[model samples]
Target: MKIQIRLVLILFNSCLCLYGQENPRLDSLLNVLKTQKDDTLKVLTLEELFLEEFYTDPTKAKKYIEEGLELSKKLNFPNGEGFANYYLGAGYYQTIGKNDSARYYINEALDIFKRIKHEEYIIKMTNALGVVEYTSGNYQKAIEYYNIGINYSRKNRHWDNLANRIGNKSLAYIKKGDYNLGVKYSIESLKLFDSLNSKSNTLQLKIHTATAAVRVGYAEMGLKNYEKALEYFERALGIYDGIDDIVHMGHTYSDIGNVNLELGNYDSAIENYMKALDIAKKKKIPIMRGHVLINLGKTYIKKGDYEKALYILKEGLPFNEQFGTKDNLSLNFNQLGNAYLKNNDENQALVYYNKSIALADSINAAEILSDVSLNRAELYYDIRQYRNAYLDQKRYQFLNDSIFNSKKSQQIEELRTIYDTEKKEQQIALQEKEITVLEQQAEISALQKILLGIGLLLSLIGIYAIRQKMKRNMLEKEKVDAELEFKKKELTTHALNLARKNETLENLKSKAQELKDKENMGRGYNQLIRTINFDLQDDNNWENFSRYFEEVHKDFNSNVKTKYPQVTSNELRLLALLKMNLSSKAIANILNISPEGIKKARYRLRKKLDLSTEDSLQDLVLSL
Candidate 1:
């Protein structure tokens, strides 16, 4: 098989510590929720409790989310409400693997965050929305959302978050079958987090790096670099093993099993699967166990153990229905269908395949849908249903083509061309250097002949050689200096271009606003919004505005960027609001700053542009 099954984590990396007994963190949160006298604190604690249980205990997580939301509303606590909504969304997607509920709750939370001007959670919820799309198999759309978060994280110096989003984007590319880009981005992300961890060296950073390494492994797996994939998975496994993080450890074990399975090492795959199952049973995470069970069933099928495959797939079905996302559900159904088909249960197999297809279509899961279509078509052909079989066969081809299409092939070919060109350039440069060396040597030989008659021949030749060496060294230094300068310029330009595209995509995303209180909420959320009142003002996309989608208002805020290219989105929002003649108090509240803070911001802006006191900051901003 060219394909391998993978264990997917959430958009953000969260840890679940499973103790042999009751978890202290969960117990503490439960105690706080029941006993805390502070109403607002109680609401916040409930949200915390939800996070603790979301992975292992979905029932409790849902209960806590409901309790948290109700109480936050009672106390009018916007922060409490925002977090409560956020986790409610996360639980739906991460725990249950349902996109409809997940999208609704995540969008709701995003709205709340925007309203309250919670910049951090706003970006986080945005990332969460991307995760929902990713699990739904909207890989390209997911990458767009991830890019927004990545760019925002870079500009704001949120290195940890930047790493997370970059890893996520890498996964999207892998799923989209852009394995080269997947490898490219994952390595960059791993290096970035590694550098950051060197400075912090925290346990959290270690976990982050481990999560990141797993993605790199997945990218390698996509590229069919099985050895490299195994290497990364083992490295991540080692980290999780050291931390005793059984949930993550289970994932890494399964990843290693996948490599062995791909290599036709069935016995090794089973061994690794058993190890993962042992951890899964001990920790009792329904979702993780479901994945392991399904994967084990696939291995059995590969081994031609049809009866065992059927049994395993059936056993995993309930757990998946209870905890898996739509992707997981579709996959579970597809596996069951496959097991049944292999076992000669044609009637049952067709039923399961239909179920899988329905779920896949609902979520636009091209990969799963394509596989199941082909599976069902074969069964239909076997049962003498020629017409139905033909239709399904056609569908399979269409979906497969859409996923592994010519466009993606062309893109990869383009990247290869660029890499090849750069390599050729380097080769040419090396040849030029070689020619220079040859010329220097010829000159030395000619000098030796001229000095042959003198007793000072050896000394003169030595002096000439030393001087040539010095000249070469100086020339090399100059070339290195010039290359360094060029590289610095190239890197800066690349960064800005990426940021610009990210901002443009973000703007396009938020063009449609459901919230009506635009003036009350203000447009500074994109800059920074921190308050207890969230009315949600859409402060957003520009060049793509002509493509049938328009912002909520028909203002020319988009034009400001064109006029002043130096201004960032965050800075542009401030300038846009001032140009609209909003009050200082309103602007300060929207920007989550005091009046003095605004003054300082304006002063800093002036300093950034090297403006004297006489030059108006407002005028400079308005000109943009």
Candidate 2:
């Protein structure tokens, strides 16, 4: 059994290694595939070849998987078709980073598995769903699917599958910041692998154990247990070294560097990070290179080498922007800010900090938000912007607390779910025992059984009725939301129309004045100019327009006035026009002022609002 498993592992790794640069195995595989006459064998070979390039060359992997899928469909091989779809989903997710497409393909594969009642593949595909959710940062949903997969694996006594699911759960916990629980699950997975008696599969078990160790190390790092983290990382490194896993070895080196940096072993950290960076570059791993660059740049910042830090960080920006993970991008931006700040370039620091915050907010990355907010608050304090400093400090505290509480809540909910499931299972067993005993009772009457059946039917009918009511309520709520959105659009359109008409009247008055000036001493032209000027300056028309504008943008004028009480009425009119997104020339024509005058008014408005040069007056007005 152990020898057979070892051969399987060798074959799998050999297939993957075929895609490695300078490998002769790829040409050998292609030669063999070309000579193969059996369609089934050809499809199987294509699947193996596709997995080889799945991560390293996704475009090529996709072509191979599509060919395999087409062949399987033509051969009416449902199992082959399901596997092909699964790999296609995995390729999209891990290589191309398209979670939606991944989810769709995985679901399609899942349907096929379910239709064929393939329990083992169903469990694997369910675990794949967890992986998709994990990549999407839906930690709680990922945990749910992982739990489901684990339960199924356990019931089927599939120890290897169970270990993999547990390892995945550990990763999800670590990502969610429940370091303690993550460590617990990692240990549990290691124990399970240790208990397996497949001597022939010892290498496979060792690989699993090594992965679990790395997870534990990450959890320890998250928990700030640097010593424990180093121990686990070293252990994992040893295992990977034994297997000649250069990729994982590179990752472990970076992990060690992070711990060393945190412990203030700056020289050791730099050395380790440089080693990792060298490996990444040699292997052409863009993501690893980006991450190692960030770590190196941050280490330089800590060492007070601000210029070096900035150079390194800026070099990493394009790589990170192109292919790094979102978290890595946030870290790069934040590190750039720190480097700039250390160099006494406060303006550049602020720009990078804002960029970091924007990216973090878009991804709802609470951990990144906590770190960036604290750094931003300190930057604000250093620049003597006390209000902004205070606001950012508050934001940091809020996010820190939220992250802490969310992790705690998730852990508690997981435990509660497990407890509930176990308790319900126990109750089900007891009920089964009771039913067995009741079935042996000959004294039970036929009338009692009939009444019991009627009671169950009535209960099911009540459940159906409640479901119907819920469906109606949901439809009603959706209808109301649609109506509200339509009304909002209608109001905005009406306000814009009124602004346009007001601008047209002002333009007409300007044209009439020009005509009167060109044709001097003409009583009829003079009278026409007077009429146009009266219409343009008409207070009633202004009042009517203001009323309509306020209705569309409720309390906008009042909000601005409340915020900047000293703003003059002319500035208020300027604000209104700005809110409509009108150009400077159009606003000047509408307000009967020159463009230069409008510019001066905008400057004054900025002063009254205490806005920096970076702030857009138009955006502020529109937001209000």
Candidate 3:
């Protein structure tokens, strides 16, 4: 709430005073309430007073809520009624486990907000419902609501709310025992808040960043990174200290206590928890008090003060049950069982352990179940119940394995989500930079005189058109060059085929002549020689090669002929082969000559074309 108010105040230029996180002193609010008339202002003031007392005194908060609801209904003010019901529902669920009543009042407010098309209130109520589910131990349902808020906030570019939703989602993951994922998402939330903070030095963004940091601490604590978790917790404490956020300040102190407890710093743990307890009691925050009380008792148990542990645990049990989730209550039971066991009260220890196990099973807290099962197993073995001990030992193994496997899958999913989120964050940053550049360009364009701006716009258009035309021409030239290359390869293939056929014919002609030299010449044998020679010199073979060559180098024939009027058709054919970049041996085969003869023919052609000694025949022909 503090984070949202600060953002709205700075970014939107003003914030709704009634909806702000700050509340007037009880005396001040009472005076205003007495003097204020029965209108919207009175209803709004009542709502604000309800919020001020909501976490501290549920009964007093309810008085303000009821009065506000009745007055708003009489005035037909949906927004006021929505705020009243929302606060009432928050009090019902958080103060006591009135699940049905909580859902009824919250949903009623939601319906009213929807009817009035109050999008912001709808989002707030939806998040509240999510918190309700989270408090009820419905982790998945809570995540679904957080996702809804994330989607809406992202679409609206409400970065503060988006960061809050993401931070809330991390809490759900932590509760669900997906600690790695909780850390990943909490870090993402921190980064977003940091980005917003970098954009402007707003206290709201800093508070949100600290809140995200605290969530990271919780997630790290879940992963057993005590020292690292302490760093985050202390950092957040520093921020909350600067603000009048009693609710978060107490929670942050409790988180620091938890890290100290994990690190075996019993004295430090007690100190932090006592600080949290002081804040919780002084501010009348039930949830914070309950949480700190439970941790304080656990700290004493760790310090080997069993009697102190037992007394503190018993004193905090009622508060924990009333305000905390069942899983936390189950943990408290397990700790109580441990304290009793340490004090050598076997019967009381067994009773508390059983209660803890039952609660853990109901909530499907596999990690808690595993711990309790192992503890019970040891107790049973101590009591000489071999069979019960063995059964609990098996249950512990099963739950431990299940939790390990569940964490493996969650880690895999988290890896993919982290990658996708990183990609999106990068894209968003790039887009924001682009928008800044565009805005600057728009400002520059606006500053330019109208006629000059028109002239510059016209010049840009003309330059763009000319550049486009050049690009098109270059593309067309490339296309023609590619076609020419293809044709050249095809022409080479045709020429090679003709060369092979000509070789066979020349061999046959030699055989026929050999026969004529060995014996007397016959008419049919001479006719065979003629046919072989004719086939060797077939124009049909040249026809296909010539056609492809012309297609490959369209201007070659005309340009060469025009340059050298004395050039013959045969020399032009040799020039075409040279332009194809054929080897001397290949050219010899195609022209029915030896390699030496083909080289000499090229030398003669070069001289005929008036080429210099330094000139490359292939380079010259290729250019043509």
Cα error, residue 379 of model 3, in Å, equals 1.6
C-alpha lDDT of residue 64 in model 1: 82
lDDT leader: 3
Candidate 3 segments exceeding 4 Å error: 1-20, 136-141, 195-206, 419-624
Can you rank all candidates by TM-score, best first? 3, 2, 1
Worst 10 residues of 3 by lDDT: 1-10
lDDT tens digits, residue span 1-624, model 1: 222224345344631211212245777777766778759877867766766776677787789878889888888888888777777776545545567888888888889889988888888888888877886768879888988998899889998889888888888877766676788778888898899988998777788788779888888987689999999999999988987777778878888998999988999999998898888888787767787888799999999999998998898899878766677778888989989988899999999999999999997777789899989988986775544664686687567547644444635453554356445655666566556655656666676645542434465457656766785566567545644543443333333332333332232224212121453533543322221112223222223222211222234456655655676766755664565455666566555456898887777667766789899877765554
Q: What is the lDDT of residue 11 in candidate 2?
A: 19
lDDT score for residue 176 of model 2: 69
TM-score of each: 0.59, 0.62, 0.62
Write the candidate numbers in order of decreasing lDDT.
Answer: 3, 2, 1
Question: lDDT tens string, model 3, 1-624?
Answer: 011111111111111122226567888999999999999999988877876766567688788879999999999988888877876775545446686787888899899999999898798778778877876778889889878888999899998888888888888888777787789889988899888988886766667777788878878887888888889888888877777666567667777777777788899889988888898788776666666777788889878999999998898888778866677788889989999999999899999999999999997877889999989987876775544664686687568657755765665555556556655775676567556655556766555645556665577568656765785566557546644654565677667756655654565566667667777866656887776667667787678688878886788899998988899898988888888787777677678887889878888888897889998888888788
lDDT score at residue 435, model 3, on the 0-100 scale:
62
Which residue window of length 10 is worst by lDDT in model 2? 1-10
> lDDT per prediction?
0.70, 0.73, 0.75
Q: How many residue pairs clash in each candidate?
A: 9, 1, 0
